[model samples]
Every structure is written in structure tokens, then in C-alpha cells.
Target: MNNFQQTARVGLFFILGLALTWVTFETLRGGKVFKDQGYNLIAGFTTLKELKDGDEVRMAGVKIGEVERTRLAGRRAEAVLRIDHRVRIKSDAAATIVMAGLIGTNYISIDLGTDAAPDLPDGAEIKTQATADLNSVMSQIGDLGKKLETAIGDLSGALSGGKDGKTGIIAKVDLLITENRENIGKATANLQEITAKVNKGEGTLGRLINDPKLHDELVTTLDEIKKGAGEAKNFIANAQKIVDQVKAGQGAIGALVFDQKAGEDVKASIANLRAVSDKIARGEGTLGKLLSDESLFRDAQSIMKKADRALDGLDDTGPITAVGVVYQGLF
Candidate 1:
């Protein structure tokens, strides 16, 4: 019976030792006893962003593998992923480091590539993309906060009109009001006077404002002006129509201006007129000589004087005697 008890105690101790060994192995191996028997894929990135080995490799939020190791390759860092053999990753699959939470661990996340793409081979290099680090995000937020604070301070300063200069909006407005105070007072007085006049129905403007009949008359005048504008528009349209017809070679003026034969004829007539004008200027024609000759003018004046003396003698003499006398005078 004692031998049996000792044997049972030895068996219990062996089982306890085996359980402790399993627990330690599970802890060291990230809860998986058998090292992930799968294909390895390489992913390179500028930064790992706190991604460590044994971290989950997820596809669409489902754990599909684990990050096997991380090592520096030349200037860049590379992560080796052990993907489950059952899960087929396409060659175009991209891997990126993702934070589980704001203060949580980081992991490898992958997008499910299209099925049309070929399956990636073992030991293939998967594409990697860098994500914004928490530190960088915090730094950018601090910078943006500072800029916003500056803008708010500037706005407050502008509204309060800081005494630095006349650059603030409130300061400029106050300066303008101070300079125009007298003008503003005059304007206010004028407005009050105009209001009194309007109430009493004084001037044409006041009457128009106070009396419906005058308002109606003004409306009628405005309607007449509108009618006149319409008539002017119609006149302009008619003029435009005429211009368009001329442009289209549809009118007599258009034909004279656009037709080659009519233009040639006009040119020939102009040439003839120019030639005649030139001849006249040079005293080449009868009319030209009549206008230009001084001898003809003197002869005309002498003839007129002789004719007057003959006519005067004729008035006092008999017809035959007058004729003889005129003949004797001419000779």
C-alpha cells in the first residue's frame, strides 16, 4: 500500500511539472506551442512604430498570422511575417503597422488583396506603408493649437483696438468716426429736417413721399420712362437689324460696298472726276480758262462799259442816227 502511494505521488509530481513546462512555453511562444508553421513574407518600412515580434498579423481585423522578427536591413527596417499556410495572401497585399489603441500595443495589419492577383510565394517581399506615429500626431496638434491661439489673440486684439497702432479694425473705425463727427452731426440735422418736410408734405420729394396722388404720378412717370426705354430699345434693334442686313450684303449700301463690279465702277468714276479736276486746276478746259484768265475778265469789263455808252446814246437819238453813231463810236 505504501509503494502504491509513493508511485501515485511520483505520477502527480510528473504531471504538475509537465503542466508548468507547457504554461512557460505558451507564455514565451505567445500562446502557441507549435511555432507558426507557415510561409514567411518580408515587409520593409522607414519605421516600425513600436511594432514588436509575436505581435498579431491581422487581415481585415482577423488574426491571420504573427510578426516573426524585425531586423535592420541597410538603411531601412524590415519585418518578417509568418502567415498561416491556410490563408492565401496575394502578391499585391500591403502590410502596415497599426496601433490597437491610443495606449496599446502595435500590430501588423494587411488589406485583403484582390483574388485576381496571383498568390504570393514563400519568402516574398510584401509592400509596406508608414503610418502616422502618435508622437508626430501630438506634435502636429501642439503646433496647430499654437497657431490657433495666435489667431484668436490677434482677433481679440483687433476687436479691442490695441494701442500699438491704427491697424486694428476697431481703432480705424473709431478714428474715422472722430474725423467725421461734424459731418455726421450735419447729416443727422439734415435728416431730421427732411423728415419734418416730408411730414408737412413740403417739396416735390416730400409731397411724393406723403401724398398717394404724387406717388401715383411718379409711378406713371417711371412707367413712361420705361416705355421710352422700350421704344429706344426697339429703335436700337431696328438699327442693329439694318446693320446686320448691310453686313449680310442684303441692302443697296451693302451691294455698293461689297460688290466688286460696283466698286470698280465707283473707282473709275472717281478717277474720271479726279482727271477733270486736275485739268480744271491747270486751266485746260473752257470753263477753266473762263475762271482763270485775267485777259477775258478785262475784255468783259471794257465791253460792258462800251455797251452802256451805246445804250445811253440810243435812248436820246433816232434809230438810224443811233445805229450810225454806235457804228462810228465802235470804229
Candidate 2:
């Protein structure tokens, strides 16, 4: 009976252990019993971060598969992830580590590329991305600590003036205040006085702000100015009437601007001058005859050309040769 009791107790303990192991396996597998239902892809990262075996492989927000293995490939740590065969990953799929829960294990996360992209092949390398975690965050905070130390050092130096016998920020501020104290007081007093005057009403500005009489005066002045403008416009209208009379030839200026007979006379004189110019151009008068006489023009051209040739040869011909040419021409 003692042997039987002992045997029963051992079996019970073994059963409990099996049950616990199954439950642990189920939890790690993310409630999936068969792991071969997914397609496999590989990715590489420099560090594992906190990822583990049996971590869920999620695409977007949906659970797709499980992580198969994590191993060192050369200098990079690589992970083999199995995705649901039904969930087709594109050729450009990216994977990163993500926390499964607040305190749960980290999982492999995938970003699905656009539908227009080609499907990724089995065993293809899914691009891996580094995810920030506690270690990176702590490293960043350490750098921040150093920056904080530098900022504090600079602030201390500025406040205490670089550990030397120089005036500090407080001393400079004090000196500035001392130098400008009287001017600051005067400015403050002036501001106070002006504010008081504005409140009580005194100058033209005060009248514009606080006096009904000033408002009335401004309105009256505007009305008077408007009346004067109306009178000026009336005067301009009468003057325009006089100008219209002048344009109608009822005055000296009118005759100058609008006399039709004078215009006709000017047109006749212009016509006569144009006729004379035409006669000259056609060689029908003295000027035209002179211009159109070709033999006379040729003679003059020959004389001018000879004179030009003589002048061009002057330096080489000598003064005696020039005198001989003038004498021969005279003969």
C-alpha cells in the first residue's frame, strides 16, 4: 500500500509537469500548435535586441506567423521568420523587432509593401531595421547627460566669469542698472505724466480723444471744406464754359484754334511748297536740271577725284611736285 501510494504520487507529479510544459509551449507559440502553416523568410540585424524563439511574426497589425530561429551570420545577427502562406509578403518587405505586450516578449514585425509590388519568394532576405529599445534609449540618455553637463558648465562659467577675477553676469546687470537708473526713472515719470494727462484731457490729442467740442469742430470744418470744394467745382465749370466759347471761335483763342479759312490757307501753302519740292526732284526747275545733268555731274566728279588723289599723294610727291600740279592745272 505504501508502494502504491508512492507510485500514484509520482504519476500525479509527472502529469502536472507535462501540463505546465504544454501550457508554456502553447503560450510561446502564440496559441498555435502547427508552425508549418506559414512561409519562411530571413532577415539580418546587428543585435537581437530582446527577440526570442517562438515570437509572433506580425504584418501591420495582424498575426501572421512565428519566428523560427535567430543565429549569427558573419558579423550580423539573422532571424528566420515564418509568415502565413496566405499573407503574401512583397519583395521589399521590411522586418523589425516589436514588443508583444507591455511586459511580454519581443516579436518580429513586418511591413507589407504595396499590392502592385511582386510577391517575395521563399527564403528571400527580408530587409531588417533596428528598433530603439531600453539599451539605445539609455545610451541616448547618457549623451543627454553629457550635454547637460556641458550646458551647466557653460552656465556656471557665464554666471561666475570663468573662475577668474572678472565681473560676472550679476555684476554686469548691476552696472547697467546703475548707469541707466536716472534715465529709466525719467522715462517712467514721463510715461506716468502722459498717461495722467490723457486721462484728464489737456492737449490737441486729448481734445481729439476726450472733447465733444473738438468732434463738433472737426465735423464743421469738414462741412466747410466740402462747401468750398463745391464752390471751386462751380468756378471750374464756369471757366470751362469760357474755354468752350474760345474753342467755338467766339474769342481770340477760339479763332486761333478753330478758324477753318486759316486752315485752308495753310493747306494751300503746304501744297505749293510740296509742288516746288516735286519740281526740284524731277529736274523740271533749276535745282532738278542741275542734279539730273549727267555730263556736268561727271565733270565735277572727275575734278573732285583728281583733287582727292593729289591730296593723298601729297606726302610722297613733295611740295615742289604739288606746286607743279597746281601750276599745270591753272594752265
Candidate 3:
């Protein structure tokens, strides 16, 4: 009875050990014991971002598949995804490896592609994109920190003007004061004297400030200026009104300036004047003939000479002889 009991105890211990080993294996392999009920698709990327087998594949924060396997094919690395058969992944869907958190595990992430696109077939390659790595980000941050430190050091050196012969604000100000001390003293003394004279009412500016009569005169002058300004404003308003009237073609000047019909009439009158002048130049009218002919002057001169001769004959002869001579001359 004792020997039989010992053999049974050993068998029970062996079975317990086997169960523990199986549990550990399942835990390490992501706990998927049964066959995955899904079709496979391949995804290729420059890097998998620490993605491994048995990682969950999610679409829109929901788990729809798992990464079945990963492999290095030629130059690029690839991950085979086992997607749920019921979940339709579009042909244009993209896949990427993303971290769950800063220190959490990485997983394959699928995007919900457009509904109009066809479903991705089994064994088809899904598109992939490379993500920013944490290590690279940390390295960039360190480099930025170093650069910022350098800039701050440079700014400090400029402000403090380190003892290495570099000029700074403080050094320049001290030098300026040292060089102009005598001029500054003279300016201060002159300012004091001018202020004393002003207090004593010894100049025109002082009288302007302290004398009541001058103040009243200044006020009167200012009032006159204000009155003039009002008149100027009225003049400007009248000028603006005239301009508006001109723009509206309301007066003769406005009509000549803004009225199209008036301008056309003026142009027509100018053309008529030109035509008349041309006619006159060609001796085609009465005025043109009067200006161009010389026969009228000759006829007037002959009449004048006959009248003189007739007058002389009247003075020398008797009444009947004078009448006969005048008749002959007239004829």
C-alpha cells in the first residue's frame, strides 16, 4: 500500500509541472492557444517600431486582428497580419506600428479606409508608414538643449562683457560719461542760468509766461486766429459745394466742363468756324471778295479828281458856262 501511494504522488506532481509550463508558454506567446479565425495580409515598412509576433492589430481603437509573424524579406522588413474574416479591410487601407504609450508595447494599427474601395484580398500587401522613434526624439531634444545653453551663454557674455576685452553696454556708458564730463557740466550750468532768468521775468519767453497784459494780447491773437480759421472753413465748404455743382453740370462752367452735349456743340462750332475761314481764304464769299479786290479804290480816286476839276471850273466861269462844264465833267 505504501509503494502504490508513492507512485501516485509522483505522477500527480509531474502533471502539475506540465500544466505550469504550458501556462508560462501561453503567457509569453500572447495567450492565443486555438487556431486564429482570420485571413492573412502582408505589410512592409522601413522599421517595425519594435513590433513582434502576437501583437494585437487594431482599427480605430478596436482590435480586429493580430500580427501573425514578422520577417526580413530582402531589403525591407515585413509583418504578416491575421485579420478577422468578418472585418473588411479596404484595398486602400494603411497599416503602421504604433506605441501604446511612452513605455508600453507596440502594435500594428490599421486605418478604416473608404467604403467605396474594394476589400483587400488574402495575402495582399497593406501599405505602411514609418513613425518617429522615441530614441531619435530624445536625441533631438538633447541637441536642442545644448544649442539653447550655448545661446544663453552668448547672451550673458554680451550683457556682462566678460573681462576678455569685449565691449558691453556698461563699458560704453562709462566711456561716454568720462569723455563728455566737461561739456555736460557746462550744459548744466547754462540750463540753471536760463531757468533763473526765466524766474525773474527777464526775457520775452518769461514775459509771455508771467505778464497778464501779454497773456491777454496772446488770447486776443488766438481768438482772431480762431475766427480766421472759421472763415477758412466756410470758404472751403463753399468751394466744395461749387465743385459738387460743377460735377453735376449745374452751371455754365459745369456744362462746359462736364456736359458731353455742350462739348460736342463747341466742337461743331469750331469746325464751322474753320470751314468759314477756309472759304474766306479761297475768296469764295462777299467778305473774301472785298478783302481780295483792288478795283473799288481806283474808281473812288477817279471820282474825287473829277469833283476837284468841276469845282475849279465853277469858280472861274459864269453860271451857265459853269453848269455846262460840270455837266460835261459828270458825264
Candidate 4:
């Protein structure tokens, strides 16, 4: 090959090597070329749930880092996680392994504590949250089944093996069934007789079910009651309507209740009557003067007397003489 061809082949191989390295790094470790921000937290639990190294550590749904190691620490299991230093986590943050999706791979989930508190120090042990362990759940279910079996066995023993050998409640019940066989047959026949009577509409209760007239009467009575109730409702509604009219000043009672014009007319009439009363008290107008003045009363009395005397004289005097007496009396 020529020198240019050799240089070209070397460049292509170098590019291939770089691409392969990138692919390999991505396969080995999750995430892109640029490292994400995170923080490391420790959680100790009895079971690690098969959490493996290189599992993603997430905080508030954002990828932070990977699990570095897991091992038995003292009486508890510990998982070492390498997290991005740039990620902010609280001292109370929780680290847990959670499944990604249903039937999917598991990932490390870090619950970011409330942002109100200060960030946790590097490699600091954080707060832990315990979820239901699969083995523990199975054990509890098995214990529940055992308790149920114990309860059932106790009940069976109590029923079958009693303190009394022969006179237990179940044994007494069986003896009673055996002794009352013929009496039970007679009682059963009596029950059948009663049922037949009821089915044939022979008893009062049966007639209540089978009689059409009583049913029709009941229906009619209900209809009448409904009609009465409707009428009562209509009457109440009309009364309410009348009350509303009175409130709105639409009728005679309404005018008395809310009519400003009627009130003003009444006030005007009262004022006129008061003026007339005051006039009477002061003896001002003709009628008021007539009512208040004693002199006018005396004058009226004298005029009535003169008329009576003149009428009495006319009974005795002739027509010409009566006229002469009246003319003289006037003069």
C-alpha cells in the first residue's frame, strides 16, 4: 500500500477504537458520556433484595449514581453506593431499591428529603425506610394460616369433645331429633293444613292477599287521600301566594300592609281632621263656631221657642189674626 492509503486506514481504525470504547463504557455503566450529579447515602436492611453493583441510584426520578458494593455488615446488610458529588441530598434522605416497571429490572431509588434542610455530608449514613420484604410477607401469611387452623381445630374440639361425656348440646340436639320423629310428623301435617288454608284464601290474612274488592277499596282510599293532600297543598300554595301579594301591596290587605299612597292618604285625612278639631277648639269656621259658641246655641234655642209659640197661637187664632200677631211680634 502507498503512504496515503496507510494513513487513511490508521485514521479509520482509530475512529473505530474510540466508538467501541464509548459503546463499552455505556454498556458497563448506565447513562451518557457526561456524568450526572448525585450524592452517596447508606441504607442498612436485613434483606438487600438482590440489589447488584452498577444499579442506578435515583433521587426524585433523576439518575444519580450506581451501587458500588453490597455485603453483610455486622447483623445487617449494607450496600455501598457511589453517587455524583454535585447532587444535593438532605441528611434525612432515604435510599432504597425499587423495581423500574412491572416485570422490569430493579434500580436504586433515593428519596430526596425535604429541601428545607441542609445537604447531607459525603458518605454519610442516611435515614432508611423499610418496605415489605417478600420472605417476611410469606412468613406472615403462613402464620395467619396456622392461626386459622388453630381456631378451626379449637372449634372442632369444643363441638366434638365436650366436658360432659354424653349430655352436650350437640348430643342433646341429636337425641331430640330422634325422639320427636312422630310428633314432628303430626306438627308438620298441622303446618301443611294451615298453609293450605292460607293459600286457598280461607283466613283473614289470605283474603287480604286474594280479595280484589279490598284491594280496590284500598287503592280508591289512597287515591282520595292523595287528592285531599293535593288540595291541601294547593290551598297552602294559594295562601302563600296571597301572603306574597300582601307583601307586594297588590290587594286590599296588601294596600293596608305596604301601600305608601294609602298611608299618605290616611295621614292627609288625619291632618285635615286635626285641623278641623283645632278649628272647633278655637271656634274658627262656621261649623266649628256653631259647635264651640254657647251664644249661637242659645240663639238656636230662642228661635225654636218662637216657632213653637207661633205654631201654638195659630192653633187658637184665625189665619188673619195669626198673621197680624206674627207681624207685631216681628216688629
Candidate 5:
């Protein structure tokens, strides 16, 4: 009976150990033992960035799967993700390794692609994007700090002078001031003298500033200029009105320029005048004959001499006989 009790006790202890081991394995596997392990998808990355097996795979901050394993393929690394079968990952969905916090473990972050996109097939590779991990960022920051330190040292050297006995900016400036001290003093003295003269109204500028009469005259001149400008504006307005009237065909000049009938009449008159002038030049009309024929001039001269003789005869005769004598002489 004692041997049987000891054997039973050993058996109970072995069973207890197996139970504990099973429970620990189930917990680590997320209690998915004897259940559907889901489909696998490959995610390729330049680096896993501390990702390991059992790390959560999240979509929009919600865990939908976990990393099954990580392996290197040629020059790059890839993670095998075991995704829940119910959660369909679209073909266009991208995966990225993201950190939860500065000290938190990294996870696989996925984006919800468009609803119209087809689901990615099992065992197919999921798209991955490179992200700046904490280590890389820290390393970049360190490099930047070193570069900044070097730059600052260079600036310090430039400002404070180099080790080769070169003069710095401050030293050069001091030397310049020392060399030009007398000139600077003269310039300052001249400025003071000019200011004193201006205060005493000794020059044109001084008078313009300190003389009330000059100020009043300047104001009066300004007022005159304003009045002149106003008159000029009114003149321009009147000129513009005249121009508008002309443009509207309201004046003589406008009629001459824009009235077709008036233009035609003027053209006709000019044509008629030209015709008459041509006739005169050709000696074709009475005026033309009078102007161009020597015979008519000679006849007029003869008639004037007969009239003179008849008038002399009339002076010796009675009034009734004077008419007869004038007529007989002209006949």
C-alpha cells in the first residue's frame, strides 16, 4: 500500500508539471492551440528593426495578427506574418515597422487600403516602407552634433583669429578706428558746427527752418501752386468737354470731319470752283475772256476814249443835245 501511494504521488507530480508546461505554451501562443493558425503573408524590409516572432501585427493601431518568424533573403530581411483569416488585407495595403514608444517593443503597422482593392493572397509578399528607427535617428543626431561642433569651432577660429598670427575682425576694426581717429574727430566737430549754425538761422536751411516769415511764404507758395493746379484742371476739363463735343459730331469741326453729307457738299463746292477756275484759265467764259483776251482790253480802251470825246462835246451843248451827242459818238 505504501509503494502504491508513492507511485500515485509521483504520477500526480508528473501530470502537474505537464499541465504547467502546456499552460505556458498556450499562453505564449496566444491560446491559438488546436485552432486555425491563419494564413501567412511575407513582408520584406531593409531591416526588421528589432521585430521578432510573436510581435503584434497591427492595422490602424488594432492588432490583427502577429509575426510568425523573421528571416533574411539575399540582401534584405523579411518577416512572415500570420494574419487572422477573417481580417482581409487588401493588395494595396502597405506594412511598416513602428515603435510604440521610445523604449517600447516595435510592431508591424499596416494601412487599410481602399475597400475596392482585392485581398492579398496567402503566402504573397506584402509591401513594406522604410521608416527611421530610434537608433538611426540617434545616430544621425550624433553626426549632426559633431558637424555643428566643427562648424562652431571654425567660426570661433575665424572670429578670434587663426593660429598663424592673422588679425581677427575685432582687431582689424580696432586698428581702423585708431588710424582714423583724427579724421573722425574733425567730422564730428564739423557736424556740431553745422547744427549750431542751423539753430542760429545762419544759412538757407537754417532760415527755412527757424524763420516764421519764410515758413509763411513757403505755405503761401504752396497755396498758389494748389490754386494753379486747380485752374489747370478746370482748363483740362473744358478742353475735354470740347473734345467730347467734337467726338459726338456736335461742332463745325465735327461736321467737317464726321458728317458725310456736309463733306459731300464741301467736295461738290470745291469741284465747281475748280471747274470755274479751269474755264477762266482756258479763256472759255466772259471772266476768262476778260482776264486772258487782249482784244477786249483794247475795245474797252477805245470805248473810254469815245466817252471822253463825247463828254467834251456834251459840255458845249444843251442838256437834250448832250444826250444826242453822247449817243452819236458811241454809235
Candidate 6:
């Protein structure tokens, strides 16, 4: 019976040892004893940000794989991701080291690439993009705080004074106010007096504001001026229309100014008038001879004298004798 008890105790101890050994193995191997049936993808980053083996690899927040291992390859750190055979990652899928939370572990997060993109092959390098981690953000915030502190210090110094015994803006402004106090008071008094006069209808501005008759006259004058301006605008528009018509060959002036055929005709008429004037001046035509010949004028005067003699003879003779007398006189 003692031998039986010893054997039972040994068996129990052996079982416990096996259990302990199994738990330790599972912990070290990330709760998986058998190798994962998946392809490997290399993801490179400048810094992994505490990412390690067995960290989850997720595509759009869904777990698709695990980071099989991490290592340094030359200048950059890399993680070998074991993606499930059932899941396919596109060639354009980018990997980023994302923090689960402020206190939680880091993981590899991927984006869903375009559907038309080809699938990534085994052992291919997955593209990695840098992200602003909490540490970097905190560092930038600290820098901003320092800059703000510096700016505040400068503003305070400028407003109060420098340490070099020079007067500050506030002090200088106060001194200026003290020196100009009397002048400022005089200006303010003048302004108040003017405003009082204006309110009481004592000046032009006062009348313009307080006297209804004057206001009506001013409005009438403004209306007249507006009417005159409208008339001027209409005049200008009509003038512009006339000018446009001239440019477009649409009226008599337009034809004379813009029509090539009409202008050519005008030039030809002027040339013909010049030629006729030249001929007249040179006594080449019958009208020019009548105007220029002295002989023609003398002949006309002689004929007038002979006709006068014949008329004088007819007054002194009988009808038959008068005819003979007029013929002899005219001849």
C-alpha cells in the first residue's frame, strides 16, 4: 500500500511539471506552440516605437496577422510579419506602427489598398509610413511652450521697460500725454463748442442739419445735379453711338469716313473738279474764253452802241424809211 501511494505521488508531480512546462512554452511563444501557416512580409521603419514579436498586425483595425519577429537591417529596423494564408495584402498596402493606447502595446497597422492593386508576394517588403508618436507630440508641445514663454517675456519687457535704463512705451506715452494736456484740452473744448453751435442751427453745418427749408433746398439742388448728370451721360452715350455708327459704315458720315468705295468716289470727284478749274483758269473752254477774252467784251459793247443808234433813227423816221435807216445804222 505504501508503494502504491509513492507511485501515485510521483505521477501527480510529473503531471504538474508537464503543465508548468507547457504554460512557460506557450507564454514564450506567444500562446502558440505550432508555427503559423502564413507568408512573411518585411516591414521597415526608422524606429519601431517599442513594437516587438507577437504584436498584432491589423488591416483596417481587424487582426490579420502577427509580427513574427523584429530585427535591425543595416540603417533601419524591420519587422517580419506573418500574415494568415486566408488574408491577402495588396502590394500598395502601407504599414505603420500604431499605439493601441497610452498604456497599451504597439502594433502594426495597415491600410486597405486599392482593390485593383496586385497582391503582395511572400517575403516582400511592405511599405512603411512614419507617424507622430506620443513622445514626438509631447516634444513638439514642449517646444511650443518654450516659444510662448519667450514671446511673453519679450512682450512684458517691452511694455514695462528694458533693463538698460531706457524709457518704456507706457512711460513715454504717459510723458507725451502730460506735455500735451493743455493743447488736448483746448482742442476738446473747440470741438464741443463747434458741436453745440451745430446743434443750435448757428452755422452752415447747423442750418444744413437743423433747418428743414435749407435741407429741402439742398435736396432740390442735389436732384438738379443728378438730373444734369443723367443728361450728360445720355449725351455721351449718344455721341458714342454716333462714333460707333461712323466706324461701322452705317450713316452718311459713316459712309464718307469708313466706306472705301465712297471715299474713292469722293477723291475722283475732287480730282475732276480740280481739272475743270485748271482748264477754266487757262481759257481752254468756251465759258473760260467768255470770262477771259478782251475781244469778246469789246464786240458786245460795239453791238450795244449800234443797237442804240438804230433805235434813235426809228424815233425820227416813218416805218418804211425807219427800217432803211436802222439797217444802215446797224451795218
Q: Residue 315 deviation, candidate 2, in Å? A: 93
Q: Candidate 6: what lDDT? A: 0.90
lDDT of 6 at 207: 93
Estimate, for each residue in 11-48, the C-alpha lDDT of model 5 and write its tens digit: 99999999889988976864365656588999999999
The candidate with the higher TM-score, 3 or 4, is: 3
Error of 6 at 166 (Å): 4.3
* Off by more than 4 A, model 4: 1-39, 46-49, 60-62, 71-76, 99-106, 155-174, 215-331
Residue-level lDDT of model 6, residues 1-331, one tens digit each, is 6999999999999999999999788767653676668899999999998898889999999999888889999999999998988999999989999999898589999999999999999999998999999998999999999999999988888876877524777777787889999999999999999999999999999999999999999999999999999999999999999999998999999999988999999999999999988888999798788789989889889988988988887887868788787778767
Each candidate: what lDDT? 0.88, 0.82, 0.87, 0.80, 0.91, 0.90
The residue-by-residue lDDT of candidate 4 on 1-331, one tens digit each, is: 9999999999999999999999888767654466555555676877778677678788888977788667789999887777888777787778777867555466778887887888877677767666765667789999999999999978776666566645555776777889998999999999999888878988886776789887788889999999999999999999999999999889888996698889889889999999989988888999888998889999888877887788778778878788876765444
RMSD of 3: 11.4
- Model 3 C-alpha lDDT per residue in residues 28-127, reported as the tens digit of each score: 7754566566899999998887889889999999999888889999888999998988898998889888899788589988999999999998999988
Per-model C-alpha RMSD: 11.4, 22.6, 11.4, 12.2, 9.0, 7.4
- Per-residue CA lDDT of model 1 for 83-162, tens digit only, reads 99899998888999999988859999999999899999999999878889899999999999999999999898877766
Return model 6's CA RMSD, one decimal.
7.4
Q: Which 10 residues in a row give candidate 5 its minimum summed lDDT?
A: 29-38
lDDT of 4: 0.80
- Number of the top-ranking candidate, with TM-score as the measure: 6
lDDT of 1: 0.88
Q: Check candidate 1 and list the clashing pairs.
A: none
TM-score of each: 0.63, 0.53, 0.59, 0.50, 0.59, 0.70
In model 2, residue pairs whose N, Cα or C atoms come closer than 3 Å (at least 3 residues apart or on different chains), thus clashing, are 283-288
Q: Identify the runs in model 5 with alpha carbons over 4 angstroms from their true place.
A: 1-21, 29-37, 192-331
The per-candidate count of clashes, in order, stands at 0, 1, 0, 2, 0, 0
Q: Give the CA lDDT, 0 to 100, for residue 186 in model 2.
A: 99
Error of 6 at 138 (Å): 3.1
Pairs clashing within candidate 3: none
